[model samples]
Target: MSSNSPFPSLLDGTLSLPVTPLIRGALEHSKKITSPTTVNHCIRSAYFAILLSQKLARKDAEPLDAELIVYSVIMHDLGWAVDKSLLSKDKRFEVDSANMARTYLQSTKESGVWDKHRVQLAWDAIALHATPSFSQHKEPEVMLASMGILADFQGHFIANQLITVDEFKAIVGAFPRLGFKDQFIGIMCGLCAYKPETTYDNFVGEWGCEFGLDGKGTGKEEYAKNRLASTFPRTLLPTLIALAEYENEAPAE
Candidate 1:
């Protein structure tokens, strides 16, 4: 077992959340350079990403993928570990996270079997997961990348299992601030692909092959309304958690 942080453990065909050493280190590093509020947001984003991935996987009848989902979510924001300058919308964060993932995987070759393809898939997924708009082709990594991105954005609407409309608005407010509106919108389209009730298998399949899913339902308007009504709330939870943290840390006179 690596001592850096506890790795997520699988039991009864489900994964239990494990402390991510990489994420913890990133959090520590981020705190030094990022404001307390931003650091809290980062942590909340990661947590909700993990939770949302599990929910989506279960909803799609692909519970076996939870551990992979957890791993990806924990490290998704870890590019912030290396350089604060990479904190914004720059592509450096993607490259930095990808390189860090490569190093981590290479360093732990004995933990499990690692095929070149699987490793590459993991690397690519982490690298491109944050940028949905740029991925116009379908691939295995693309599915995982979509999963990661969807989980990240949807986490903004959920709180303690209850979805808040106000928090959803706040999340929308913060969307353009992150320079990720296109990516978020792209994931929404992906989620509604094939049909409104599309399963996880469809999600995985459509990931690397195309820009948008089958576009089921009446049209874009109805589809958008449906997606906003069902899923985005679960996604919003993490953002709310981070906001709560910000409130807790407010300066007192």
Candidate 2:
């Protein structure tokens, strides 16, 4: 990957992918469960995170483990897998994904390579990848991983000038988006329909607010419109929807 490194990257020249065996395994597992869109997003997140980290130029920062970033981010959305079994009924999608990544690291054939600390680090990166307020302040690995993911979703808002437009195009060129927004929203909506409780606190909850299968209002749009009309005074729309749903669901006297 680097000038002095012996590990040959699957990518060559410029920004490269240090293709380790574990990374390969992680990619295969991701492909088996989730759609190719997610798989590309995960891989892109690693490159974006690494490049952004380098741009940050933290003096005396510990060298980032690229394999760890790739392996961890690659499976960050295993909870969104088409396999269904990985999608838990009770836990948030992030939590489910984190647990799966942890298990993979623990079960790898490379003994002594992934100690408990490393495994936990991977868990933190995937689990907290969506929680910028907290993850942005945690370890470099955690923050970088989260930022990388946020960049992929939010783009310039999160990356600022760190990742230039050309750089972004190159990354997206290598890994085509393929209607990521629609696909991602569809999956979250499915989550809301299947396990609304798990989406109650996150952005997923917003899409969940729309799906009628949750037994909320007459329908999603009317319910959301009603909530928008009333709850505008108290809280944010997504938070309001989640709170209203929970309040309505409680057993009444």
Candidate 3:
């Protein structure tokens, strides 16, 4: 991609982090999709995944294997890029995504830098990120899968931010599971104000918050905290914490 090209600009909107051929391929694939909505969502999700991964890396005490993890998450939806129908929670799609990552990586100049084992890991992570049920591998695979799921979730949340207040209200009206008002309150309580919530404290204290969600409320504050608190088998809290800090630093551009 050209440095001044829109593709690079689009990619540049992502977190400043390492990317692999697998990730690049996913973006290229996203460009080819026939539907504007799907293309937009996938593109945003790709950027979201990169942002979340970089945020997580920042908060880590030890250096993270971020390139590998972020690359895996970016490629998680490759199947959807190849065929819109592959967006479903089906085995074929999962395999397609995985194979796409492997094929793309191998076809690129970076292929030599990554060994066979690393490529295998990438394949496994990209493939199962969308289908955790199919994940039997551990470590990077699990991490990648969790990142992908959370990326998708956070992408939707970010996408909502782009909508008008009325449009957002309509979205929440259609999807009550989002708990719009509650989530908004939660975000306000945590992020902007950086204050604790008595309600979240009470709920999490009684229920014992998983990650940071128990008493975190359900607003943007909670969403931020939830992003940090979520983990494997639940949500990736560490990753969210990193992302929260990164979001805090994002330039207004």
Candidate 4:
């Protein structure tokens, strides 16, 4: 396979892809388990990530790791598969997907190509893709992966800021949306149905609020109840004498 292959032009330059056996395997695996809509979404997100990297001039820093970006983006949503066995009840869907990707990356015959640190980067990118506050400040691979997902889901706002209309059209043309919104929502709801606790305080919580699950109340309501129950009342504090005594014994900051 070629070390680098030309991708569709965006932002007046052709994107160079690092073709590798791992990347091909990731794409194939994702396609087999995920719906066509999801596969297309993953591919588009990879393109968006590349475009965002170019827009931010990250390509100049150290020659962005195209293989890593593709691996991270393509495998980011593997937890949303219809096969519930792929998900975890104890962790959020993102964690499950990240773990799954990490295992796959480590299992490859040429796994030596990716060290522990590189695998960790991919894990972080996949796990934090939905969190802008975290991913936005992380490494290029993490940040770009998040940006790509955001741009695809909310293209109305992000498309104009990063790429031209022609570029946006090209990406969508390559991978059509094909009712991804409803399908994605259904996937989240199904996950919550199986593991409602995973939705608390996360983006999936918003989905739970929007679409009521079978037995579980709106996630927002449950989250609010938990927050209310966990807090301590200010009125229960000790009097001034006790406060002063504690303050005197406390070490200086």
Residue runs of model 3 more than 4 Å from their true location after superposition = 1-14, 17-26, 33-36, 54-62, 81-91, 110-112, 132-137, 140-145, 154-253
Question: What C-alpha lDDT do the candidate models reach, one value each?
Answer: 0.46, 0.76, 0.47, 0.77
Q: How many Å off is the CA of 125 in candidate 4? A: 0.5
lDDT of 3 by residue, 101-145 (tens): 777677777545788877787777765564445553566434544
Which pairs clash (backbone N, Cα, C closer than 3 Å) in model 2? none
Estimate the lDDT of model 2: 0.76
TM per candidate comes to 0.40, 0.79, 0.44, 0.80
Q: Estimate, for each residue in 1-253, the C-alpha lDDT of model 1 and write its tens digit.
A: 2444433322232433445444454445455543444344444443344434454444445334334434444455455442444433423445556766666666753325657876676676667775565442534334544443553456444335432454334333433234344443443354444334432223332331333353232255554444444454556786787788767675977
Which has the higher TM-score value, candidate number 2 or candidate number 4? 4
Over 4 Å off, model 4: 1-13, 58-60, 110-112, 214-253
Worst 10 residues of 4 by lDDT: 227-236
Ten residues in sequence with the least summed lDDT for candidate 2: 4-13
- Cα misplacement distance, residue 130 of candidate 1 (Å): 2.2
**What lDDT is reached at residue 153 by model 4?**
83
Ranking by lDDT: 4, 2, 3, 1
Give candidate 4's TM-score: 0.80
